[model samples]
Target: MSTLEIRDLHVAVEDKEILRGVNLTVNSGQTHAIMGPNGSGKSTLAYAIAGHPKYTVTGGRVLLDGVDLLELSVDERARAGLFLAMQYPVEVPGVSVSNFLRSAVTAVRGEAPKLREFAKDLKNGMDALSIDPAFAQRNLNEGFSGGEKKRHEILQMELLNPKIAVLDETDSGLDVDALRVVSEGINRFRATGDTGVLLITHYTRILRYVKPDFVHVFAGGRIVEAGGPELADKLEAEGYEQYTKASA
Candidate 1:
């Protein structure tokens, strides 16, 4: 099975440290949820893994199935089977969603998908996400609502089929119905048994739907507590008060 290992990962943005010696592991077919208060470095871990230039890796190693991810560039990391669904998807006003997705697929696959097959796959993914067919012609995430952007992210995940998906607050801004739709799409992706998921969120609501195999409480830029799914239930009821207080 594919494996993503984070070893004492330390990340900083603009000379200020964010992720401080965080360590975790996710195996294919396993879903790990990271819950924490705002600015607790949950998203920082996601960006650092995706090789975001803004987040400097002060120290530590991120290995994906024995390859040192820190040695690869952002696009190279994508080709190496890493994907990140941003918390706030940016708008590309001139690039159509269809074109953008196709380009990304080509980059990751190292070959262009057959046009007919690509179209079919795109349509199927969109249909599964309940996205309108007309969205294909629209610029990527341009003029889309929060829920639509989030669904589009899942749609990309479905089509790209990365080995590891680092979803940063994907459930944010999604209404109940949208949350269900998005969660279902994630579930479908996980069913493939070849992809690992790192779900980062503040609330446990999404955990109810996605059902993480492991739950981690991120505080002070590191995991302070970890347990099974029941940990999520406890967090939902008690909140991050204890963890945050301890960190403080």
Candidate 2:
């Protein structure tokens, strides 16, 4: 089975450290949820692992199935089966959704998918996510609702089928109905048993629909608490007050 290991990861942005020696491991077929207060460095961990230029890894290593991921560029990481669903998806003015997805698949797979084959796959993914077929021709994330943008992110995950997926605050702006749809897509992805998911969120709403195999509490830039699903329930009841206090 594939594995994504984070060994004492340290990330800094603009000469200021955010993630402080964080360590976690996600195995294929497992879903690990990261919940924390704002500014606790949860997103920093995601961006660092995804190789974002803004977040610099000052020390430690990120390995994917034994390969040094911290050594790879962002696109190389994607090709190496690492996917990150950003908290804020950017708008592409001219790139159509279908074209963008096809190009992404081409990039990851190292070759273009045939028109007929790719068309069928696209249709299935969109239909499953309840997206309108006509929107495929629209510009990516341009004038789309928050829920629509998040669904598009999940759509990419479905098509790319990465070995490891890090979703950063995907449930942030979604309403109840939208939350259910996105959660279902996450469940579908988890069912594949070949992709490990590191889901980051501020609350436990999404966890109700997609149960995490493990729940981690992030505070003061590192994970201070880790446990089974019960930990989520505990966090929901008690909040991060204790952890934040302890970390401080």
Candidate 3:
């Protein structure tokens, strides 16, 4: 089984400290949720693990199956079974969705897949996410609605089949129907029992649909509380006020 270990991570953006001594571990067959208020550095933790250049890792290490990921480039991290679905997916004006996915699969697999086989797999993933076949020809996220963009991210996670997937605020801006579809995709991924998921969000609505094995509360740029799934219920009931106050 694969394991992603984050050890006392310290991250900064524009030389301003963000994450402070954040520590967590996710193993295959498990899902961990990171919950927090706005500006609690939740997204920073995700970007840092994904090796975003803007978020500098000032201290500690991120290891996937014992290999230090902080030492690898952004694309290299994906090849090592680490995937990051950004909170705000950028629009690629010219690249079609199919082309973008194919390139990503090629990079991660170190070779290209046969056209016929890739086509079949792509169709199946889109079908699962309720994505329109016409979307394959559209520019990547260029005009996709919030729900569509999030669904596309899920499609990528399925195709790439990473050992660990970091979903950063994927639940944001999704309506009820879209939320269910996205949650189902996440549930489908974890059901394989071969991937670990680190779902970062401010609300626990997604958790109700895709339950996590562990829940962490973030405040003041670090995880201040942690527990089982029940912790999420507490957060939903009481909000982040208690945790934020404690951190302050």
- lDDT values of the candidates? 0.95, 0.95, 0.95
Model 1 regions lying over 4 Å from their true place: none
TM-score of each: 0.99, 0.99, 0.99
Residue lDDT tens for model 3, 95-191: 9999999999999999999999999999999999999999999999999999999999999999999999999999999999999999999999999
- Alpha-carbon RMSD to native, per candidate: 0.7, 0.7, 0.7
Q: For each of the candidates, give the backbone clash count.
A: 0, 0, 0
lDDT of 1 at 63: 99
Model 1, global lDDT: 0.95
lDDT of 1 by residue, 1-248 (tens): 89999999999999998988998999999999999999899988999999888999999999999999999999999999999999999999899999999999999899999999999999899888999999999999999999999999999888889999999999999999999999999999999998999999999989989999999999999999999999999998899999999998
